[model samples]
Target: MEIRARGARRPYRSYRTLIAAACAALLGVLLTPAGAQGAPRGPHGAVKVSQPVYSYADSVRESVWVDTGLDGDADGVSDRVVADIIRPAEPARQGRKIPVIMDASPYYSCCGRGNESQRKTYDADGTPLSFPLHYDNYFVPRGYAFVAVDLAGTSRSDGCADVGGPSDVRSAKAVVDWLNGRGRAYTTRTGTTRVQAGWTNGRTGMIGKSYDGTIANGVAATGVRGLETIVPISAISSWYDYYFQQGAPLQGSGPDWLANYVESPAARARCQVVQRRLVDEAPRTGDVTALWEARDYVKNAGRVTASVFAVHGTQDLNVRTKHLGQWWDALADAGVERKIWLSQTGHVDPFDFRRAEWVDALHRWFDHYLLGYDNGIERAPMADIERAPGQWSTDRVWPPRGTDTTTLRPAQGPVAGVGTLGRTAARPGTTATFTDDPRLDEEDWAETADLNTPDKSGFVTRPLSHDLRLSGSSTVTVTATPSTETAHLSAVLVDLGPDTIRDYNAPGEGITTLTERTCWGPSTPTDSSCYRETAPRTADVTHTVLSRGWADLGTYASASHGRPLTPGTRYTLTIDLAATDHVVPAGHRLALIVAGTDRGLIQPPSTTPTLTLDLARTSAHLPLVGGARAFTRATTGAAPTDPAAGRSRPDGVAEPRRTPPIPGESG
Candidate 1:
């Protein structure tokens, strides 16, 4: 939709003002008396106060090795993941327990974390000198202990990096078990000196971005105790969805590549066997094997007792929107208490895009869940969505309350090239044919909407008379006859109009880092809460592809099985596009592009194939905010003279970059 610039969007001065206000408000609440806010009692039945009376610089810093009970590297000894902890010393000295915030990550030593790529640092004696990101600096003095964990096989942890498998998940779960007194911990990796997490109140919260966040999701799904909540930003719900799409490989590399990338140098030789096992077990066929099931957190959502504060970029191509869509749906079905923030940026953290709001919301969420504070955060809106750049809105629940399915079918247009999209179905025998072209991708299909391309079929509706909002995932079902035994198909939903949008293709993926620094909390000589400021990067574009889906025709009947298609037989295939919440502005048309081999995004098929679609049975079922009536009211009008009507190629438009196996060094 054509959203007007919201008061000089993302101005530096405004950010400073907002952050100051939020911090002041938070400080005021924290300084309030314990019983004044009607806060709940702690596990020990003692009334707790949400105040930052402790000193950040004087926080205790130490490390402990938690036994994972797994021999991932076939070593004689059980694997013990390392946990580097920092907590207010006063709490322990006074025998006052505090809640814990843990971040279990494989990238702490290899790829680092956050916008600045801060890695964990240690003192000469092996005690942690600094924990990456601002979590420790910001929350440690605020009555919370922050733990930085080295996932098994990475950093100081012992074992093989199994990528997203049992080793990866259980290693982190072990730390939670130890904190709750269910597992054992040692002062040293090999020493017999037992250690206890006695300072903790046995309540914990996990938070992180990307892979770090992914581990939190996995651990929470294990039904582990003491993990009271999780804040997973741009995290994966399923490793299968991360590497593949509907039996179609999205990237050439598998779990083995990622495992090798994050394995510690000390364990390289020992981890080779585990790496080989990963490659052998994870077949490139994109089948749902036992290895994938072990990593599929969505299927195990029922086991999650931890309240989730999920954050994801709607346009995130790395850990695609499907991960969040499926996981969120599953969480809802399981009756899990959840909240989400959907940003317009790509593979980005809210800390970069909406820093002030993110920090404030997170503080409240943690206080409510982990610290037993009745701050009314659960009573707030369930969703905070950035509908447009720098413009946010909230809803009681995601996909909006009145959302319903609206099916739009393609019918033959008067001319030969493009088709008309409307409520009425095409005639029984109507058909559209297109041959597979490995060179063209979703970008090519979207840009050449007015042209008749040999590789794709375009269907467009009349310009909308009013804005039509689409709130959730969409399914594109096609009954097609293929000329080959196996082929690939891609469907993309596009907004055909001129508008200014976040430049997701930019260097920072929709954000430009500024030289100005903003500190969130108290800093030490070795570590600081200060970080470079950022503003949304914008681009004027003729069209924006809202959602895209790809699938293998060989697995048309089921995602797990692949059956050869008869040359002349008609088969129905369902391609589930990623979820989105977007509004097609008035005077803009909604278009659907059905194509083959979305290069770069999906692995190309072995052979090219021509497919003919039975237009009568082919339709796009979308979750429209107001359903069919809303769609009709918006689209029923004399077509406006589309600014892009005669353009054969769009300007300032680019396809979503295929995120590499390693999202980025700064992830």
Candidate 2:
């Protein structure tokens, strides 16, 4: 791939222009073409961007409402997604078409985005006076148009929010279509006047954090035209996974409640009927319904043509690591070009975690994808992962190819209650049972004790002889019989040892604000050029929960329907824990705890559940970064392998359900 140069090379004439431009830059005033008024053009006729070129104070700001053809609010008018555009005045006015960088978000008028939770500010005339964060202030002067859009039903948009459903996806997709002159938009909800994205080059890129980023993923899945690339930072790939994991309902409210909560009060009032419809569509069983399928980009990976740059936090309990890991795998299998940055921080943007490096990398990414500039980003490392807090490493591919999947089983320990995990399977008749307790929280479960009774079960391995890195999703398969009709089984992977690391889930953790600052882009008088410094908020932790998985026993056989388990009949339950990239030091121990009814994470059943595990058939398969040989060599002694390894039927039993293709797309 060659970098595209602007204009024809003119020897001495070009040299003189460059020298003159440099001299003017040192004087603090820039020289531009006779008709233009912003940044000066280069000798090759390209935008000459100095360090921090765009001034938010000087950029053009405007707004337009794009009609979405749906009367989501039932206000007798079609819904209109509001867009706030900021562009370099000179080039834009001079007819120099520029690529667009857009963020379609629902948080504009409410919870806000970024560390400071900045919201949209408006002038007296109802025009957007400020677009929060640094995109517009920094990128406009660099010859790009930065657009901040209000997802329909939020802020100034005229509609009802649908969470991650069709209305939400279409709100962003329409903007991309409009940029390419293929969609209809208007200046008002009921106005006859139409508006077109006349100044754009028709190529667009979408990016955001959280729900904003979720819009980008949803829009890209539509295979919409003009959407060239996307940078989804800690975004949700499947709304189903966001609310429910492996049939376990993680949160109390469903999409209907979420949709109403994100909308304006007026919108909620006007769209009450729509809200009811949403509630009717989203069931409480946590099944993967068609509603979720429509919102799942992972299911439509084949429809994607836009290149993806994914950023995620390994410790993000809100969206979790599996959301990105499973989506990334689908993108890879679909032959999508992609790059990723897997951080250790919890639900954070890279700009906060690694500012300077993030800005430089993002600049090159936009230049290559949106502006069609070849900046060698395509040749860079495919994955950058945090091995430990403040420590990072790069690899050609995520999870690193040829990873060894080591399956380990639980063996009764010398003590009555405690047990040991190793490569060897336990005796056929051995069993460990746990009763469900709806009152126990995650902290209670993490601090395992009271094993004399059956509220929970715990299994641990001896101190590792060598450092081991777990790099991908771990699968836990347990054969058991539940005493109750239904149960919610929770599986947790833990690092049991004394250590000091960032407590991502805790408020402020141990992070301290520093006096130093870093600049990302040009700032306007309102938004500054710099942000405060931040580092990991460390804490002394005796045991850290690395990953978790939950399964509703009723939905184990099929994710589409729920059925009570036969009273005394034993059944096989297999579930995949969230993915991770953590290094366990040589002296540390690894543990897996399986229990019922996690009170904090999900709504537990009213009646207690007693689960009796078939120790001979229960095993956890781990994706060790070290190959199988390395794991075996580091152990104290050789252990038995799975008797069903590589066979048509694992241990002579057939799969309960035609397991869906890893998360998204239908088989």
Candidate 3:
């Protein structure tokens, strides 16, 4: 493992120029004077650092059917998942093996991938003519094979889509096994003509966004042998968390709905039974069942041997932030080598927001992990975070280094309409109550902070003298008495002030695509490395919802099942809000809004129950970057009057759907 000189690198004007330079350098060192093609070599015989000496236009493109052990579609034979491959022709022709980069997805034939909504295009002989995204274009020319896998029951694959279940995971895992010479694969769907992945050196890296990335996480959790690393961008670690918040369902649709949406037209009739099972197993009660356990990757994190490069957005309401929060923590506990990038956008790919940097970082990560290059990427900062729109920062670890929990309790304010939040707790017997209102939401509560709203109780702190940074998730604990047997509670943490921030509610979800294109790799007749550039969309707002969470009072003791509560009986419910990294500027106040039925975010309970909170026992535990001392200093200033009364609505849509919308689908 020899270290390369980082300062010797320079940015090329175009990918073609970079490829030409790499070829000249390689030819000067290893190839014959006649320029005859041979096995790809890097100074020594090792596939250490990747160089674009291979031709993307001349890459070998083909497809194979990897057999999965399970028959998810109830067919007599085993299911065979399709893997569309594009690799450098030189290495394979000369009998020299290369590593692989795979993106196993259910979206290839349905919703498509990336900002351009590009799907896989095949030629007449069933060979892939154009693979979606730039992975094939860039990595294929850099001595790596790019595998675009269609998940079981989707696209040209056999079996049924299980929505992150065993079939979905096993379908992708089998491909890795086949590349390592363990699993069986065939050249045709029904034919017995066998195929072997002799071109691969058995080192693989998986990468994708959303559902595709979720597959990467699932496969990595299986501890597959050939997989060396994974890059899961805004992916889900647990399917239950995606559709449910604690014991409450976030939306009406379940995993069955998503399964149907991505199921191929040819397999719809055969996968009907699978869809029915998804519905039967996942009830509206949001209980943790065996079906959900199988889909949860975090629980099996200990088995993962692959290194991880996780990317997620803090404001992503579709897949939500808890997925990354929990998954990152699990990976850390298991002592897995990892890196992270946290953006300020909503359910967006990094390629759409930070293209050049993303490509370079991904290339370096794959080179170091899969190609076994000692490029010092692993020794660099572990976390790269977007502090503001277009503003970035790096740290050795996430949540900063010295983050600690700081508890803030609510007390009576000078004004009778609102409450005060500070280090001191309220009087022993003091209490505040709010009734359930299905129509109101976090936005409505944020607007009426100075008013006495019947549906919500607002608590605000005095004007801060210094900026206070919150680095991670916060917990809201409420000792409350419910008016009914069942109830729903929602807690929101808001930064009450005027500021300009990313417009995450916009049509593009914080990115405006431009007509100008940037080419990343070589081009062919149908497939090209060019894609539209994007700019960040920003908005001026009076306040921003930092984090929020929901909980079912009936399931206060257990998330597995609901136990009916006695009317008027006091019980403590702890709500874990989504993870966030935000700074409350000086002079702006921080507010906590506690309400029932946060309208579009979660489904309301059948019975509207009023909750009376014992203020002395209720508190919010915030993960503050500077801990309690910094908070005390920031809040030492004299109290100010309540914020101005106005609409103060933020830009973008009020509520994001459970699943992000596809190009032609309704949100």
Tell me how many clashing residue pairs each candidate has. Answer: 0, 5, 0
Q: Give the TM-score of candidate 2.
A: 0.85
Better of 2 and 3 by lDDT: 3
Which candidate number would show the highest TM-score if scored against the true structure? 1
Index of the highest-lDDT prediction: 3
lDDT tens string, model 1, 436-488? 99878787898976444788888998888777788878999988889988888
Q: What is candidate 2's local distance difference test score?
A: 0.72
Per-residue C-alpha lDDT of model 2 across residues 117-208, encoded as one tens digit per residue: 67777788766666777677557767889899998888888888888888888888888888899888877656879888888988999999
Predictions in order: lDDT: 0.80, 0.72, 0.81
Which segments of candidate 1 are over 4 A away from where they belong? 1-49, 450-452, 638-667
Better of 1 and 2 by TM-score: 1
Per-residue lDDT of 291 in model 1: 82
lDDT of 3: 0.81
lDDT of 3 by residue, 1-667 (tens): 0011122111111111111111111122111211112324457654345667898888899999999998998879999999999999999788899999999999888876777777898888888988888898778888999999999999999999998999999999999999999999999998999999999999999999989899999999999998999999999999888878788778667888778888899888898889999989999888988999999999999999999999988888777788888898899899999998888888888988877677767877898888887656786767777766776666667767678899999877777877988999999998888899988878789987644478988888888877777887899998899999888899899999887777876666677877666666677767867777788889988998888888888778887777788999999989888888777877788998888998777888889898998999999999987799878977886533433221121111121112111121000
